[model samples]
Target: MNTNDLKIFEAVAAHGSFTKAAEATFTVQSNVTARIKSLEEEFGVELFTRTSRKVALTTAGETLMQYCKKINHLIDEAKYDIKNAGQIIGQLKIGCIETTMALKAPEIINYFAENYPDVDLEFRSAMRSTLISEVLNFKLDAAFVSAPVSQPELDQIHIRDEQLVIVSSAQTAKISEVLNKQPVKIIVFDQGCIFRARLESWLSAKGIIKYKSIVLNSLEGIINFVEAGLGITILPAEVMEHYYAGRKLIAFPLNKELGTMTTVLIYRKDVPPSRALQVFADMHKVQG
Candidate 1:
């Protein structure tokens, strides 16, 4: 019922473990359990279903989570308004896809830190789908994601264009050569990645349907695998250059239609951005 209790609940929901939530909140497991129990009793509904391994939110808990996000966001806004008044000083949580985080985010983060020392910045690197979901759920202030985001509740700003490339080992002379290898091993990020989806589509168009998939979460890992001739992957040209520097890999430019993708900054359209977010977004506009 209280803000403190709700914060604990949110932490537990996010971490999906009572012990982990306690550690994140700087408390003990017993206190976290008591608070959650008290809330459940007060609401006459079970908030979480506990198992031997992890905890999951119940139906009532899911409904409360939506309101909890709004409430927490409002609380943050109120504190920012009172403490900073008209100043552009507050916390800005930004999310970015792995490629953009590697290639584009450093300059913007450096500039924001240098100019706005009073503002706190929290940056997260995630897949395109995860970034979009976090922004929509109020977990992030804004996010840099791949374009073609069709969420009706989100507003977007075109940040920059990235040229996509098919990357393979130095031994591979042509794109077709890599594809012709039996059981074409396609290394990529998880299923939610936009680049992976594009790569799959391109392969399908070439009548490739039975390629072996190797999922690696780390960008560096993917690059390393491609260099070792374990598999091929699609990535941004700038990213490949920055990471590999043409040391042991070959990058072939995709066709114009599939090669070019826009990285966009997206935020909730219904909510007005805080002063800090507004100023940060304007900086990107000026840079773009």
Candidate 2:
């Protein structure tokens, strides 16, 4: 019925166990059960299907959960807008792809730190698809991703151009040479990586169909594998140039359709823009 009751409901729904929710909220199990009973009585509906070991939200509960998130978000927003009147405050959740994190994320964070020190900033790194999904769901205020994002509910800014290149351990080998001479093993990030998808599409189009692949979750792991003569990978050129230079790795260019990507910052259209996010986006427009 109130914010405290909603918080208890959210915790229980999240953990799916009365005792776990009590532990998370630092309350007793009896208090959690009492609150849920009161809420269910008020609504005259069962919110959860509970068994000894698990809990699942009923249809009514799921509906309440959506409103609960929106209400909680609005409450937080109101608090921030009032407490930091005409100033940037509160925490911002930002996201980036691995390549951007390695290349320019530091400077980006520094820009925010110098400008809005009061705003607590959190940065998360993930593949492009994951970043987009997080932003769309309001989990992230904004994210940096490989561009041409076609989401209807989101607005985006073109951050900069990034050049992707194929690197191999063969110091002077060309793309043609690598394709012709051996069974190329592609080292790439996990399934949701945009660069990996691009590389796969390009190679498939070129009729380089018979190749092996190894999925490395870390950028460093991919680079290490490529440097060790284990496989080849496609990465942002600036990343390799700035961090992994002079490593006997040969960079080969691809056609524009495959090699060039526009980096973009994206956020949801429905959410009211935060001050910190507005400044960060504006900075890229002015300085990028």
Best by lDDT: 1
Q: What lDDT does candidate 1 reach at residue 213?
A: 91
Q: Score every model by TM-score.
A: 0.77, 0.82
Off by over 4 Å in 2: 18-47, 50-53, 58-60, 136-138, 150-153, 285-288
lDDT of 1 by residue, 5-121 (tens): 999999999999999999999999999999999999999999999999999999999999988877877788888788879887878899998888887667777887799888888
CA lDDT for candidate 1: 0.89
TM-score of 2: 0.82
User: Following a full C-alpha superposition, what root-mean-square deviation does model 1 have from the true structure?
Assistant: 4.9
lDDT per residue as tens, model 2, 1-288: 789999999999999999999999999999999999999999999999999888889999998987786687678888888887998777778899888887776886687788778878788899888999888667898999987889898888888888889888865466676677567789998888998998898889888888888998888899888888787889988888898897868888888888998998898766667777777778777866
Worst 10 residues of 1 by lDDT: 238-247
